[model samples]
Target: MTAFTAWQVWGRFVVNDSPSWTEPASVLMMGWFILLGSAVGVREGYHLGFDILVVVLPETPRRVLVTISDIAVTGFGGAMAWYGYQLAAGTWNNVSPALKIPVGISYTPLIVGGVLIVLFSLERILRRLAGLPEPHLEADPADSVA
Candidate 1:
């Protein structure tokens, strides 16, 4: 939906300035940005507990901090998923902007993304508990795969 609208806007730009196309295009761009931000862990990295503080800590403190962080993130995800599901389901009757699409449909991403983060946090927590190496959010470009 967003991609199609973006294409439509691009086409409009190629032609002449049409308010109809521009309006939806702007809206689509905003939605796309929000979706992309929510889908990836990038946004989470910038939030509460994620930072360079852990990097300077001793190994024991670092491990403890990361474990605590994982638990907190998992809890956050659980709450978001639960409340988001309720919001989506309870507000299913509301109409959206643009195409009058159901507002609940827009909230589907919140549930999905929250669930995904929960899953990721669980895996990380398990890894920490098992004394395995921590997974970096981004792989080093020069690291060899084996």
Candidate 2:
């Protein structure tokens, strides 16, 4: 993607004409990067969690809350996958102006990311239930302020 963008800039600045495909191609690349990165974040527990309640709660309730949160995220992932599938199928015929590819290809990342998120979240929940070690989680932001 970086190389493509550089080509775009070079084409515009040096050649006096930007490649028409670059902009749409870059946008598609950005969407894939962001969506897939977020799925990886789920696996790594990099997303923020409001754990103030969990910190103060009793062990039982804390576990309960955590399980519930994971379940909710799983449901959200399902929704994303379902809707994304619909969008992709619905737009499969629409061709990208510059890339000449089906516009639906751009939405495919949503489905991939959603499925990954669902799998990762379920793995966390199962590991928690089985008393396995937790996933890798980022440290709290407040801890670094010193």
Candidate 3:
């Protein structure tokens, strides 16, 4: 994506003939990147949330709240997958102006990411039920910059 943006800038400023395809291509790529990145975040328990309340709760209540949260996430993921499929299917015949690719291609990431979220959430619930360690919310020390 960076390379595409750089090429776009260079083409416009240096070559004086910017390609029309670059903008739409970048938009499509960014959509995929965001959706997939969100799925990875869900799997890693890295998604944003307010944990202050949960953190203050007692152990049993915390467990219950976590379970409830996981169930909610699973439901949300399922809904996204279903609606994303409908959207993709509905726009399958529509083509982009510049790339001429089917408009549905841009929505594929949503469906895939939704499915991944569902799978990951289910695994988390299962782990919780099996008495496995709770997923940590702490940021990785390695992510810290000097």
Candidate number achieving the greatest lDDT relative to the actual structure: 2
lDDT per residue (tens digit) for residues 1-146 in model 2:
99899999999999999999988888999998998998888787665554667666676787787788888878888888889999999999999889999989999999999999899889989988998865343245676657
Off by over 4 Å in 2: 135-146
Higher lDDT: candidate 1 or 2? 2
Write candidate 3's Cα lDDT for 1-146 as tens digits.
78888889999999999988888899888988988888887777765543556666777787787778878888888888889999999999999888899999888888988898899889888987898876484345786678
Q: What C-alpha lDDT values do all the predictions have?
A: 0.66, 0.84, 0.82
Could you give candidate 1's per-residue lDDT for residues 3-114 as a string of tens digits?
Answer: 6666667767776654354455456456546644653662344435644767667778877887788788788877877887898898789876565667676566667767
Q: Kindly report which residue stretches of model 1 are placed more than 4 angstroms away from their true locations once superposed.
A: 1-39, 42-50, 135-146
Q: How many clashes would you count in candidate 3? A: 0
| CA RMSD per model (angstroms) | 5.6, 3.0, 4.0
The runs of at least 3 residues in candidate 3 whose Cα sits more than 4 Å from the true structure, single-residue gaps closed, are: 48-50, 135-146
> Candidate 2 overall Cα lDDT vs. reference?
0.84
